[model samples]
Target: MDSLKVKAYGKINIGLDVMAKREDGYHEVRMVMQTVRIHDNIKVDKASSGDISITTNLGFIPTDKKNLVYKAAKLLMDEFAINCGVSIDLQKHIPVSAGMGGGSSDAAAILYAMNKLFKLGLSKKELMERGALIGADVPFCLMKGTALAEGIGENVTRIAPMPECCILIAKPGFSVSTKHVYEKLRLNEIQSHPDIDGIIDAIEEEDIYEMSSLMGNVLESVTVKEHPVIEDIKMAMIDNGALNSIMSGSGPSVFGIFDEPEEAEFAMNAIREMKLAKQIFLTEPHNVE
Candidate 1:
């Protein structure tokens, strides 16, 4: 194929555990990553121009090298010794910096599309290796389903299916700086957190209650303090019939897992009525083929 359009799906952390900061300035994290049905669209077509071109609906996303999509195209071209340039048109639906892995997914989609479009014959392992250089979550996006990610997020092991349910995602107008959240983490001050092993057991047993109870993100402590609206959204979701609500990834965008579709829709309506978030998404777990 000369050109391709790919869907870059968003992700949620079913459970995230920060082991410790590595000496290399990245946190060693163990997280259960699950892809959602919501996604951003990426269109890649060969261009006459010799330079990569990018356009996005999201004003916050840069069109230059700072954007992960740009970086991915550049990386792939240089690595493969290809001279062709492509124009990337992004219809961004995923909120930026909301811990949804939007950027990472976009980059991964580009790599996957390019490999097929250009007949690069790259293996999935090679694609993941390149994705690791793009971002911590990029590698996981390559598989786009449930997996246990570890070791600064490069290591990925496909796990059992997460509960089949609906998710109500609320993203306030403000964006949380990931670096600031990590900086504010008082490593020693964190109290008893969720048991990751127990979470895995719950997943194995398909116990939503046990899984919800252990759903914790230490970064929530940092971001909720900076943005109280996150806490309010969490409470509103739970009150509106969410089985469990917690901020996804870093902050601002909190998600409530609902056992029933009606409950998720109700929580989405509650978030809309409260005007707590600028964007609200009701999505289900992606059942990857």
Candidate 2:
């Protein structure tokens, strides 16, 4: 194929816990990541000039080397001694820097597509290894679906898909720096950590309620303290009939899982009325086949 199109799905962290600061200056974390239906569309085509170029619907995203997609293409070309270039057109629907893994997913999609376009015949493991060099979340984005992520988020173990449920995601009109969140984290002062194993079991059992109740993120303490609006969004979701709600990943974006679509829609409408979320999406868990 000379060109390919792929969907880069977003993710939500059902649970996140900071274990310890690694010697490499990265924090060890344990988290359950689940892909959602929300995604960005990426189209990659071979270019003859051997010059990487990227275009996105969003103006703020960099089209140059600063963009992760460009980095992914360059990594592939340089590593494999390929003489071709690629043109990446990103139609972004996922919120940027809202803890949804938008950029990482896009990067992963490019790697996957480029491998096919160039017929590189790279194994999934090889692609994942390459992705790790780009970003911690890139490997998981390539894997997609549900998984247990640890070791600065690069080490991933595929797990059972999350139970059937409607997910309502909300992102406030601000961004949180993952670096800032981790820097501000005091692992020693953590009051409680999420029941990571329990949530895993709940997913295997297909118990949506149990899984929802177990949802937690230790980073919430740091992010919510800085921006009280995160807490407000959680409360709004719960008040509107969410089984449980928690901030996904670092900050700002919060998600509520509901057993019924009607309940999720109700919660979405209520949250919309409150104007707590700059962007709200009603979606569901996406399991990669």
Candidate 3:
């Protein structure tokens, strides 16, 4: 049996702005999400009886149809009317529900590997479109790089020559529920957005300072206040000389952006010494080698 392995890269929200809640029960969002070098490894093989089997070391994660990877494979087989079974083994290094879009990345990788293994020959655009059904961020992860996402996270606009930056991701021992975070949000609450124009300009000019200053996540307000330790993690990064720091996604994982790998490494070591979070990782941007 032939098998193929693919890298499932995690993502960081460089800038996330929650515009407003829509009638569809989802919020309108404007975000610049970049895939980082941090990743989970996935290996897929052909299965005999038209069954999907997923194995992972992370006991907390589901391996059944509830998993996004399983759903993604099912979507492709059903859509293209193909007949085959697939066995997916995931080396789940990324923390679950850590705001890094780990699950979404894995799902996207599964779709990509299956497409290639089965010789489906789907274009990148078609794969992204199909990926949208798996999750809001799955499509973006399908074509990893830098992208501006909107409209429940399905609308994607690509950005080229994204500056090289190092990432420091720190996940605390606890997890925050996305549902609870959204429910706690208040429409009338005072809100601020990252400098969208400044961020775009930074990407265009490849300016690290400008990019750092513009990195902000509106969801931080909901997560930080609930867990004071989250604020501590941000402070630790800043104190360690991170160029910019922000909480990613809806919860507990926080990332510090650095212009130099040395700076990011310093911050990672500092965070590790303090033992503030469950784990700390130093990584760089994703360009798909």
Candidate 4:
């Protein structure tokens, strides 16, 4: 195929814990990550010219080498020694820097689409390996589904899909830098860590309530401290019929789990009316087929 189109899905961390600060300056983490239906549409086509370029519907996203999509294309071209170029068009729906893995997903989409567009015939494992060289979350984004992520979000183990439920995502008008959040985190001060295995078992049993009750993120302590609105969003989610609510990833974005679609819609509408969120999405877990 000369071209390919794919959807790059976003993710939410059901449980996140920092184990220790490693010598490499990255933290050791254990987390349960689930893919959501919220996504960005990526269309990649071979270019007649010999340079990589990107066009996106979102104005704020960079179109040059600084963009992950551009990096992904460059990586593929350099590694395979291909002389041809490609153009990427990104139709973004996922909120940027909202702990939703938007950039990583975009990067993964390019890797995946380029593999097909060029007939590279790379396996999923190989694609993930290539993705890891770009970002910690790229590997997970390439293999969209529920998984247990460790080793700074690079080591991923596919797990049973999350129990069926509605996921309501709320992002305030701010972004949290992953580096800043990690810098603020004091691993030694952490008193409790989520039961990662228990969450795995909950998914196996399809127990939504138990899974919701188990949701936690140690990073919230640091991110919320910097931006108290993160806590407020979580409280609002819980107060508005969410089975459980937690901030995803670094900060500034909170997600609520609801069993029924109507309940989720009600909560989403309530939050929307409050004008607390810059963007609100009523999405659900996506299981890779």
Candidate 5:
């Protein structure tokens, strides 16, 4: 294939737990990572220019080395010694810096597309291994389903897909840096951690209520402390018929799971009226099945 187009699906953290700071400087994290229906559309094709080029609908995003998409292409080109350049066109839907793993998802899509475009013949496991070099979250994005991520998120184990349900995602106008949240996190201050093992069991049984109720993020204390609006959005979602709501990742973005589709739509409408979320989406969990 000379070119490829794919949907770079975003993710939400069903439960995030921080263990301790490692000597390498990355935190030991245990989290249930979920792929959502929300995504960014990416199209990649070979170019004659002999340099990586990126174009995106969002102007504020960087187009150079700093961009994960560019980095992914560059990594493959150099590692494989591909002589041709690459052009990437991105139609971004996932909120940037919202803890949805948008950038990582895009990078994973590129890695998969480039492998096919160049016929590199790498397996999914090999691609995921390469993904870790780009970013911790990239491997999980490449995996794309329900899984438990530990060890800075590179160690992924796919669990059964999350219980089927309607999901409502809300992102306040502002974004938070994951680094900032991590830096501010004090493990000593945490009262309790989410029941990750129970969450996995809930997912296996397709028990949405048990799973949603168990969903939590340790970073919430940091992000919500900095921005109370996140909490407000969560409450709004729950008040409007969502079964449960929790912040996603090191987030400014919050997601609420609904047992009924009508409830989700209703929550979306009410959330829109409240004007708490800068960007609101009604979606569902995206599983490989």
Candidate 6:
């Protein structure tokens, strides 16, 4: 095939807890991550001109070497000594730097597509390993589905997926800097961590309520302090019938699990009416086939 079109799925942190800060300045984390149905569209094609080009729908988004997708494609082209040029077009829907793993997922998707496009014969494990060179979240983004990410988010373990229910994603107009949140986090001041073990059990048992109730993110303590609106969004989600809600990643975005489709639709409409989020999406959990 000369070209390929793919979807890069977004993700939410079902639970996130920091264990310790490594000497490398990366934090050790244990989190439950779930993929959602929302995604961005990416198309990769060959260019006869023998030069790489990256383009995107958003005007401000860089299509240069600075972009993760560009880095991914460059990494493969350089490492594998591919002789042809490539053209990449990204149509983004996922919120940038919003803790939803949008850029990482796009990078992961690009790696997979390039592997096939060039007939590189890279295995899944090999793709994931190469993916880590771009970002810590790249490995998990390549893995997709439900998984446990530890050790700066690269060490991923596939786990039983949380039972499917209505998932509502709400992103405020602003973005949160992941680096800023990590820097502000004082491990000493943290009094609680998400019950990851319990969440795993709930997933295995298909207990949405139990899993939702157990959801938490220690990073919220930092992000919410700066954006009080983050907490406000969570409360709004809960008040409108979310079983439970929490901030995703180092986030200005908050997501909630609802009991049913009707409640979820109601909650989405209500949240939309409140003008609390710049973007609101009603979607369900996504798992690898």
Q: Where is model 4 more than 4 Å wrong at Cα?
A: none
lDDT of each: 0.87, 0.93, 0.86, 0.91, 0.94, 0.92
- Misplaced by over 4 Å in model 3 are none
For candidate 1, write residues 99-123 as lDDT tens digits.
8888899999999988987899999
Residue range with the least summed lDDT across 10 consecutive positions in model 3: 187-196
The TM-score of candidate 3 is: 0.95
lDDT of 4 at 106: 93
Clashing pairs in model 5, backbone N/Cα/C closer than 3 A: none
Minimum summed lDDT over a 10-residue window in model 2 is located at 79-88
Which candidate tops lDDT?
Answer: 5
User: What is the RMSD of candidate 4?
Assistant: 0.9
**Better model by TM-score, 3 or 6?**
6
lDDT of 3 by residue, 1-289 (tens): 3699999999888888888999877888888888988889999998876888899988878999999999999998888776678889999887789888999999899989988988888998989998898899998999789888999898888886467877899999988887788778776784777876678779888887888888898888888988888889899998888888899889689998877777778888888888899978888888643
Question: What TM-score would every model get versus the actual structure?
Answer: 0.97, 0.99, 0.95, 0.98, 0.99, 0.98
Ranking of models by lDDT: 5, 2, 6, 4, 1, 3
List where candidate 6 sits over 4 angstroms from the true fold.
none
lDDT of 4 by residue, 1-289 (tens): 7788899999999999888899989999998999999999988888889799888998988999899999999998998988889988999999899898999999999999888888888999999999999999999999889999999899999999998889999999988899999988987787778888898899889999888898899998898888888888888888989999999999778999998899889888888888888999999999887
State model 4's lDDT. Answer: 0.91
- Candidate 4's TM-score reads 0.98
lDDT of 5 by residue, 1-289 (tens): 6788989999999999999999977899999999999999999989988899999999999999999999999999999999999999999999999999999999999999999999999999999999999999999999999999999999999999998899899999999999999999999999989999999999999999999888889999899999999999999999989888999999999999998999899999998998999999999899995
Candidate 6, which ten residues in sequence have the lowest lDDT sum? 46-55
Sequence-dependent TM-score of model 1: 0.97
Once model 5 is optimally superposed onto the true structure by TM-score, how far is the C-alpha of residue 118 displaced, in angstroms? Answer: 0.2
